[model samples]
Target: MTIKRVGILGAGKVGIVLAGLALKAGYEVRISGSGSVDKIDLTISTLVPGAIASENAEVVANSDIIILAIPLSRYKNIDPTLLKGKLVIDAMNYWWETDGIREEVLDPTLTSSEQVQNYFKDSTIVKTFNHMGYHNLQEEALPKGDPKRKALFVTGDNHAAVDEVTKFVDSMGFDQVVHYKLTDGIMTEPGSPLFGASLKYQELKQIIDNFDHTDFGRKISSTLN
Candidate 1:
């Protein structure tokens, strides 16, 4: 599938930087915040000059792919009807400090992306971009084959969708080193040892290799099984 235009929800740091990357990758990027377009227009102009600041509905209406960068607490509020059949990137993590203690979002049986998938049942959901801190993500992007370049983990049940997002992640100047089904994405979630790690391919791969031995990994494994 050809993905050209990208729509990003949440005009925060992650959203702005992602929009900038998409712009650098030659994709037309549009972004929306939690409020009115007028509220986010100036920030969008200053931080991501080329991205259009519009309402959430407009972003979904005008773009080929939708990136959900909004707070995990607000996921239920995202209108699923407008995104029916859309390819959606779920990039939000449920940080208790930031999103409060959301019991449903913390359901041990599913990753946050899976909860998002359940809500947006008709949409195709791929998970990535949530494990790294926005600050590390900003400084780590490098050209392909660069030694310092970081690796991103992408997860989805659909192989074609995983391959499609792998290209998009590469366009954002990162390598796609690990991928699995969406349910198996617990390895890249908030409690995973890999989260917030800005490591090169070998280092990250090493961690992925030993993840099943980690306490969090075992916890997830037992819960999901």
Candidate 2:
């Protein structure tokens, strides 16, 4: 399926960069921010040409693919109903210290992406675009036919949705798009090479296979602390 239109929910660096790439990939793009329209317009124009800047509802209503490029902490503030039946891409990270919350305690019950999926139950949530930095996202993009291009790992419960996202990832210059079971996304967490470092498909597979599963919750809790 062609991703003809995309709505980016945030006007920050990550959001604008993704929007620009989506536009380059021939998708009609719109961006929304909590900031004023004038400020958003300037930011969008600087980052992405021929893109529209509008209120959140307008962006949501106009686009087929919706990208949540905000912080993980902001998920609670979003109304999931607004994204029902859309392809929602989660590209957020949990920054405990910057969020002014305790760093050592994670809710052992869920990873950040899983929590985002839970919050947006009606939408098809696909975890992607979180593993790389904004600069790398733009600078490291490879041509579609390149043999050494990077791989993008995506996970979601819905097979059809994952396929759609995989195609989008391919269009964005990744030579390989790896699909994993929803629960397997933890393999791509912060400390993992898949988080920010480039790795071949086989290397990524080894990382996943070698991941320690013992007391996973406690392990995550310790990391948070």
| Best candidate according to TM-score | 1
Query: What are the candidates' C-alpha RMSDs?
Result: 2.3, 2.6
Q: Pick the candidate with the highest lDDT.
A: 1
Off by over 4 Å in 1: 212-225
In angstroms, the error of model 2 at 106 is 5.8
Q: Which residue pairs in candidate 2 collide? A: 104-224, 104-225
What's the distance in Å from true for residue 137, model 2? Answer: 0.7
Scored by CA lDDT, what does every candidate get?
Answer: 0.83, 0.75
- C-alpha TM-scores of all predictions: 0.92, 0.88
Model 2: lowest-lDDT 10 consecutive positions? 97-106
Tens digit of per-residue lDDT, candidate 1, span 26-114: 99999999889999999999988989999989899999899999888888888789899899999988777777856755565666777
lDDT of 2 by residue, 81-169 (tens): 99888899888776655454633323556676776777788888888888777888887778776667767677788899888888887
